[model samples]
Target: MKKFQITFKGQVYELDVEEIGSATPAPAATKTVAASTPAPTPVKSAAPKAAAPKAAPTPAGAQTVLAPMPGKIFKVNVQTGDSIKRGDVICVLEAMKMENEIMATQDGKVSEVRVKVGQLVSTGDVLVVTA
Candidate 1:
């Protein structure tokens, strides 16, 4: 059994909880002996976790630009066949009452404008495709 102390609304409470694997009930004699003895404190251990690999910033020859966050496309600045350079604003997205500029990560000729103005897009949704 585990003992816990909780404070709520200025009131304090003491609670006892049993572990899941310990399903059997204690005998009357054992219960009495346990009530007379104090319980031991628990210790916690921390372990480091490995970081996950990230996707490539720019896709191959024909690349698609994805939305970085969930939002509605406020405006699309480019069309098919448009020439663009790195870091050029491709669209304006509105999310959480803020406007965000979606920029091109690499220089390419836009082959597809995947999303339209006023369209709702989610994180990682394709916004534009470049060739």
Candidate 2:
């Protein structure tokens, strides 16, 4: 059984979950067989751990909003040198058939525009540089 805390719709709640199963009992006939078999070696997966949130900027003003995921730049709403408010729509990236609004992470002028409409972008491809 595991207890977890979850928050949604402005309300937080505690949830208790129980596994539906009975514990296995040791059988006398299988006791020797279990001891004869070597313990299975644990598999160390080559895959790395769950990545940290990439949305947060590495450092302030050196911010460059990336694709977040592999996607195409659908539309660019802001241009170079435009003074933008925080959270302004800088571009639209279409990933998995959804148009995602790429927002300005800080209040600054768009110093460089690296993408345009209908351009396919990969992860970490600089879209716009703000300073």
52-75: candidate 2 lDDT, tens digit per residue: 545333346466777788898898
Encode model 1's per-residue lDDT on 1-131: one tens digit a residue: 66787665555667987666556864333344477687865543334445655543555668898999999999999999999999999999999999999999999999888789899989998899998
| Model 1 Cα shift for residue 53 (angstroms) | 29
Q: Which candidate is the best by TM-score?
A: 1
lDDT of each: 0.83, 0.77
> What is the TM-score of candidate 2?
0.52
Candidate maximizing lDDT = 1
Candidate 1, superposed: residue stretches over 4 Å from native: 1-60
lDDT of 2: 0.77
